[model samples]
Target: MTDTVTLSLADLTARVETIFRRAGMNAAQTRALTSVIVAGERDACKSHGIYRIEGALRTVKAGKVNPLAEPVLDAGEGTAIVRVDAKGGFANPAFELGLPVLAARARELGLAALVINDCTHFSALWPEVEAVTAQGLSAMVMCPSYATVAPTGGNKPLLGTNPFAFGWPRADAPPYVFDFATSVAARGEIELHRRAGKPLPEGWAIDADGNPTTDPEAALEGAMLPFGGHKGAAIGTMIELLAAIMIGDLTSPEVLDYLGTTTLAPFHGELILAFDPARFAAGRPGNPLARAEVLFEAIVGQGARLPSQRRFAARKISESQGVTLTAAEIAGLDRLTAQGLDAVA
Candidate 1:
């Protein structure tokens, strides 16, 4: 009954990348795009997993996300923000060309805010946070694009399912990672239910006139409700402001145009903020790292833990028992790759 299947992460990625390249994506683009996809599935964010490859292909087939947009960075911001320019769309804008440059820019700024406009999906935010955390730095990154929902208690789509991710340096175990979308639901989640022919739960979206909706098609056309009603809406708006307004990369008008095109899905106007913890706490001496380690052990020991514990636990289970896949989904993957059941082998 379930439509999920398991495959080795590395093998699945190679085949997926090959398929994308066969579809006309260049090597750089294929690797970048596929890596994000793989990371999502490995981390158990099914919303952004292989389930999204079909949609990503749609955009590619439509020529929306240029598989060749490589990003370039400027490191000379002495006292202000690090500057990045999307290098005329050479490859997809995720980790390959954009996210790395953004992180590098953050390193240069010390207290940096690196922004990327007209970018692609960075996949799961937690990994990104984990990366920055590993560097003994504190970083928060958010991506906001286009409107998908109306204000709380009102029905008028005005913002995307913006997310905020933060990572703090931990002395032991995994660095504390916090990453989640600021909406009640992500569009990716809705797409999953739609693909499986399931109705959505209440409180995820509202209708055209600002009422609630369960029909995925109607929900897609309606406003997405905020996670905490008005409070969530306000935070979502803040993400838009920081990513779009402050960065000046994506705007509402552009979002509407791209939405209509069906070929140009994008994740632009992203803001990445980083601070070097070592710069602040490193000089304190007395093994500052040791002090943080003690605190982390205490918290995780009691199990009042961070954001990604459940996912880690799920991954362990997934590894032991394997992932469950529906026959239909397997068939869909077969169609996408045209490789039949060869992927399983």
Candidate 2:
């Protein structure tokens, strides 16, 4: 059995922030990243939680990610498009810098798009979407990963396990948010399965020889299958253009060539679009959120749970109790802190 240690949310964030600070991230960047990391754990998204710390450190050491990044924003006049250059940093600071602009632009223009480039994105997309929704705007974000998923009917891996997230504000509760990978399962899930020495679910991936396999190790060496067959592949390909090609950043395949191994982070691109429903439905009854609540209640009454409902519930529990971290995770924090801030500087 695996050993675990319980840590309060404050402790977890403080630990994570300390490591990032030691790694040369400024307070703003450290706080932004710490928020994301803590939220992942609070929401029980283990795949995107403390487990990612080691990889983050490695990327910083490898010179693939800049810890002292300052994202620069360029806004177009008379247009709803804003571009953010992450300057080879991680996505957290860029999102922190650009999300406010996205909301403001959406409010001013009724719709806005924020294209983020030259960053390594290593967390779940739900946090970004939910943040926008909290600002009373609808939001969507799409990002491509290092290629680990194959197109339908293609044995070779040509697409990343592209993820897409959407959020809608609610009148009475947290926003209804949903985030998913086009692949049958996220590559991180496969890594977790590998760590646990467990078999993947059927249809998740294939062997190196292109035969379907449940072995996580084999699947890692092979390719992940897209969800819903060709349908998922189509969406994944669309995300490639929206998140990578259109942003003039390296595509998934191009990223794969650069990383040379799936273990490293690929500084890629992300596309986020936000819309102010108030601009469109000014005359609607009770506003967009009230209307959405009616639908949300109806769905729940029909025995269907809204997306992220469980995560929201889990957050409350985590706040009351604590997040459980593995020994290795704690050790990792210790090791990084032991290295001292001067080492990274």
Candidate 3:
């Protein structure tokens, strides 16, 4: 629990893998889950951080996730979609595996799209965006899950925050990474605050009966409002149709049969699109990321930084200082691991 407990990232992952296997996950599952979780902690996306250790173990135990499903790729012509076979709720591996398929297709066509059905949310979209950004491509990621909110003007819990994220490659700066959940707040974030026994921040959520409340427990029963009001709701709805129905066969046929399924797991339906900006703007590619940072720095009278810039730095810091796990989260991890180890033993 000490902040000074310096476990090499590789060593910590190895231990996580071994513990999972001892708890009944196969090697493939171990690799898939650990790789994603470690990346979250190392990248300092604390919300998606090691805190997920317990929830994942629960999904694995409740038969909500497959611990050994591997990816199988299929290709015919213009595009390729990878079926994650996450088994249940394990999606990080599928996301990792699906990247290259989309990247390769992008390399061939300059514009490529991939739909990842049936994988878990796996925390943040940054990890996936960073990979594509590193390859000099711009990416858009959209995903849907169980209903977590009513449409902005309504309260019915009929839609998920259904996150949408965008990343643009930069020549002189960190990737122009922008990620935000469509809801007022991410469910994982709400859960984190709940676990910490903290009150929900104002405007983040409403009670189950549609009344606004800052009580974490009530917020869980209620819905997270959309960010841009109707605008945010509209975007989430558009993404739902695109991510869930189009690729899901629930809407557009052109994208339907592209993946053969509409949903993946209990709450996961994801769509990712990537393009070489050269397709949009010819000569003199603009450095929007750099320019934005400069303008913001001038306004705030501080040094410049961008979205993924902080994460890039945090990743390095982790290499030097090691990942930090709050004592409470570590305890949660220990408890979750003990249950899994007992379940199959």
Candidate 4:
């Protein structure tokens, strides 16, 4: 018998939807959650793929996330800021509910921001960024996770592995986009390493005593280091200031205190800014989009690759050939689908 199984993207989505519905998630929650989870699998981003279902279920079982919440949007009638109260649900549905309003405001005002509060966000930011870019606008997204990373020169966890992402639209290709955690490595990557019984790369984290280590378990127990030391730490801090503090939402420390453990997804907020390129360049000489193309071509000519290139390529393959999962992963899915919340702990 084969050791792996491949399912069409539709099939995978249905399976994931079934799992979440069985776990007691509402239609909105399950639909949005399944989209991002399946997108992760389609793009081969295993860290955010089906592997995350257990954590989500655990969060639900712990009463951390509202499985039946319907996100409410505030259009900000006279301002460029739109808002979506996740109402204690997952962030995906809130983002979906706000995107059109955010895009409309950006087109009208040249720029706009979408604030999502009181939600549990666990997926990558690229999907949200790409969604904005698909509207022919530029996008910036950021959110604070629970405290698990230490600031530069610090010995204790103070900052979350906050993620930041940016996207610029392209007339003839996939958008130019990049999304990454400010930490040296995303916490999820460390978890994946631990699960595979592999050592983490050096400089990725510190032991409980503040010394460098390659042990994923030690790193998770202690703290992860920020990328580029001071720079990443500063960026992580900025995310707290903007996405958390300024938005009147929970900061990394507050989230940690509220949850008391990192095992469940953190409760927090998100900030998404959209910019209308044409509106901003109305009086400019050259077309901004065309200029961006030239820059991209030059970069490609230098034998350098663009961000999301690999992901888009993987998406193309998955779209045609379907996503492949190891037998073990399939078994895990089956177990979760059958047991629902009981499969979590």
Q: Quick one: best TM-score, which candidate?
A: 4
Whole-model lDDT, model 1: 0.67
Q: Which stretches of candidate 3 lie over 4 Å from their true place?
A: 1-4, 80-89, 171-174, 188-199, 249-266, 282-305, 324-345
- lDDT winner: 4
- Across residues 1-345, which tens digit of lDDT does each residue of candidate 3 receive? 254355678876876776677777776667877887788788787656666666566556656566666644444355444444344445566667677777777777778877766555566676677678878788998776567667876766767667788887766656778787788887767888999999988888888788778888998777788887889889888977988787652222222223222232343557778886655454565754555556656844765545566777888888887876666665656665566645331
Tens-digit lDDT track of model 1 for 146-249:
57767787777777777888887775566677887778987778888889889999989887977778988888877778899889888888887887788876
Native-to-model Cα distance after best TM-score fit, residue 211 in candidate 3, in Å: 3.5
lDDT for each residue of candidate 4 in 1-345, tens digit (9 for 90 to 100): 899999999999999999999999999999999999999999998888999999999999999999999999999989988999999999999999999999999999999999999999978999999999999999999999989999988888989999999999998898999999899987878999999999999999998999999999999888999999899999999999999999999999999999999899999999999999999999989999999999999999999999999999999999999999999999999999999999977
At residue 278, what lDDT does model 1 achieve?
54
Query: How many clashing residue pairs appear in each of the predictions shown?
Result: 22, 0, 6, 0
- Model 1 — TM-score against the truth? 0.80
Point out where model 1 deviates above 4 Å.
1-6, 77-80, 87-109, 188-202, 212-221, 261-264, 282-302, 314-331, 339-345
User: What would the per-residue lDDT of candidate 2 be over residues 304-336, giving only the tens digit for each residue?
Assistant: 998888899999899999988788777767877
lDDT of each: 0.67, 0.86, 0.68, 0.95
If scored against the real structure, what TM-score would every candidate get? 0.80, 0.92, 0.80, 0.95
Q: Model 2 — TM-score against the truth?
A: 0.92
